[model samples]
Target: MSNATNPTAEDAPPTTDEESVSVGTWLTVFGGVLGAFIAVLNIHITNASLKDIQGALSATLEEGSFISTAYLTAEVVIIPVTGWLAMVFGLRPYMLFNTVVFALTTLLCASAWSLESMLVFRTLAGLAGGTLIPLSFMLILTLLPPSKQAIGMGMFALTATQAPSIGPTLGGYLTEAFGWQSVFYLQIVPTGIMFLILFQGLKKTKPQLELLKNGDWFGILSMAVGLGAMIIVLEEGNRKDWLESDFILNGTLLAVTCLITFVVIELKRKDPFINLRLLARRNFLLSNLVGIILGLGLYGSVFIMPMFLAQIHGFNAMQIGLVMMWIGLPQLIVVPIVLRLMPHIDIRILLAFGAFIFGLSCLLNIHMTADYGHDHLIWPNIIRGLGMPFIMVPLNVIATAGLDKEDVGSASGLFNVLRNLGGAVGIAVLATFLSLRQQYHSSHIVENVSAYNPFTMERLQGFANHFGNLGADPILAQEQALRAIDAIARRESFIMAYNDCFYFMGAAFIVSLGFIALMKKPG
Candidate 1:
């Protein structure tokens, strides 16, 4: 057997004689990963074109923002419960139904008549897309043995981790070349292909009718209300002014109350909607802790970099995408190499090295200046591309190392839920941090700009003179210079603030080096 298909030494790599994993198994795994890709890709793609979509729908920025927000809110709510859902409706039938519904919703989004209609279509689309993520994760573990699990997971992680990176770039080009609706339409070809592949490949298995018959309705409702409210608060918290907005304050309260109740109910229920008991295992908890931290770094960094370019350096969606590709394109090279090396190396060593490199990459970005461009980001990004697969792929495989086959599906769903929620929290907290720091830095810079300082007076005079030289009236030139000074001050403050944020992100992963040590090696 090829190294890629072989299991770990500890796993006593399964033989083809014992239970062969055929080519078709891997093929179906690929199909499922593609579904996961499109699900997440939609989140970033729609986000990239949200402004244009707003103009098309004639909605305000806040209303248009819900197009992406609603989809994700639905997605987070659905991810953890999907394992039970897959059990309720057999995996193959459930997946096929979701693919069809997701495709249909994409079409609805393309033809949406108004903002409200788009929100409905997008939310429904999320309901379907959310299933694809955990479903893909569940399929890989059940289909492949530990020895060969790396190959399957490497492929899945590549898509799940890298697809978000590619979405903004892909969406920008598609929307620019075609139109805003093209972002929704672009999924049609991929969805059609995914449907045909899974439909032909997956055999129908009888579902546990009992699981469906005794479905935990209360668990589902509380999970939805809790996860849904939390996602909304994260998505809109900054806009609503967090604690100051009654809507945000009340939503936060409800989210906390419902989520705590969800844990309590799931723990007491004999057959719960989510398998909360799985978290009691040490390896599972430790690995998930790492996953949550990785999620913050992964999604949080993806968000902050493009924002820096777009906000500070004036890069457009396409340009930002091009710059962001440095972080993603290298993963293609790294993931395959890591797959080959994984079985030979101590998985812990690989995880530690990856976490180290990943943290280094974040710290490297702390050197950003006002003039830093695409060239400035390459090495830091290259380090990140290489480091991430080390963490993401290994974590997935090693976390489930000791679980029974039946427990894998439930574990995968809850694992993914943490990462998704972590990403949401990371982005929200980072955004808030950026805003608060910018205000602080801007005020501090202004404090040093008084007339008592010769450098400050000289700089202000130079700006006025420069504007005056550009053929503006003296009064207009004076106003323009003052505005220019303020703008420059704010921009510098942002750069400093972003630098601090990168350092904080790096520290999280650096801390995860300790997390790597906490895990007991797979037996």
Candidate 2:
């Protein structure tokens, strides 16, 4: 009998497959991780250097905020297209192109002479950077077995999560010692090293363009327009005083129209950009709900906390960064343990417990005082660190649990988009809420204290006496007393507003628990 036809030959005893890291695999992993780290690092680094960037560029606060929003917008806009792009271009070529683009963009950003030029370069960098995270995840899935995937994913998450927390610290030091441009220069070293590694070790993969033979160009365009418009409106809305300004009103109308049209078109399109049909699966739908709420909690509190530290607590960027280290270190330690235990635990229970713990952490913020120290945030941050691994990893698994191999990419894109959109919405809403609350509280305080009130007069007189004791002229003393009273009122107003923000964040987390509880339990 022929060897191929012989049953014994077909059923020959399997030899042990020794798992050793090939040079290529090591290069790919290192290059991919480094790229992802730099991308994530750049996002937060700018936060510490925003003041320097604004001063250097002679840009307004709103304009400086766009430095971040623009990059994020570009990143989100390109994310859904990654799967299609990979299919069209093949993985190695796509990665190569992205690396080159990212590197070149980093150069431009470092040398940019104007705000407009910097924003343009940032947008390009964001477009290239956006592909790294999802592609890295895909590469890990493709190469590693299911058992080993979590550990690999944990490492990737470490780069992603830890980089942002550490970024501000490094950026603050760099900006203080060198200049604002140093943050961009930091990207060059990693990008160059990654590019060299990728060039030598990456191999071309089979193109999967046949999957998109029935391409939904119209659906893609509609969704892009809709999502882009919505993001723009959200990001710019507070800056322009949402609905009060004609620009904001017009943008809102356009965003609403595009979104409604996109939703209708997607339901009918053969292959939608987001694939709304995935939501028909109960697990996918509920997982997205969980993602959105988790995002709201994560971004809203982080956004508020930094501002509070800088404005109220008189902390510098470095101090804020140091405080955030408390949050990052615990997460790094817990993630590995979580990955090891995930397979043995009931994910549904873990997710619910995590959501509850995260909610509790947000509640802790409600107790923050003007005199609060770094220790005040430590326990709550640790709870946050523990809660995140449970919420993030399981939700990712659950979101794609029912999807076929072919559907995984599209589902991941949509899920990530929702999470980002949730963050954008959370930040915008929180900022507006804080602004309005501050104004309302300030007005209430001012109204309650009048010239006729004994308390108000007593406080003013005490301030005037203190100013006089400082050797100020009578006129200057009175002026200093009035200024001091105003400052005190503003501080009190902000404190009240901060309390409201924390409560809102806590409630948001609790509401998310219901969604988490509803996620379909895996067999």
Mind sharing the TM-score for model 2?
A: 0.90
- For residue 107, give model 1's deviation from the true position in Å: 1.3
Over the stretch 1-523, how does candidate 1's per-residue lDDT look in tens digits?
0001111111212236424776767777788889998998899988889989999899998888788889999998888877777776677788899999999999999999999999999999999999999888877776676677788889888876787788889888888899989999989899999888888767766665666567788888998999999999999999888999999999999999999989898888876777788888888988989988988998999889989999998888899889877778888888888888887998888999999999999999897999899888878988898898998888887888877756766787789889898899999999999999889998999999788989888998999999999999999998998898888888999999999889989999989989889888887
Models, CA RMSD each: 4.5, 5.7
Instruction: Give the Cα RMSD of candidate 1.
Output: 4.5
Cα lDDT, all candidates: 0.85, 0.75
Q: Which pairs clash in the backbone of model 1?
A: 6-147, 7-147, 8-147
lDDT of 2 at 108: 86
Error of 2 at 378 (Å): 3.4
lDDT of 2 by residue, 289-368 (tens): 88788778776766787888888888888888877766677877788777777888887777787788888888888877
Please report how far candidate 2 places residue 108 from its true position, in Å: 1.1
> For each candidate, what TM-score against the reference?
0.95, 0.90
Candidate 1 residue runs with Cα over 4 Å from true position: 1-19
The number of clashing residue pairs in model 1 is 3
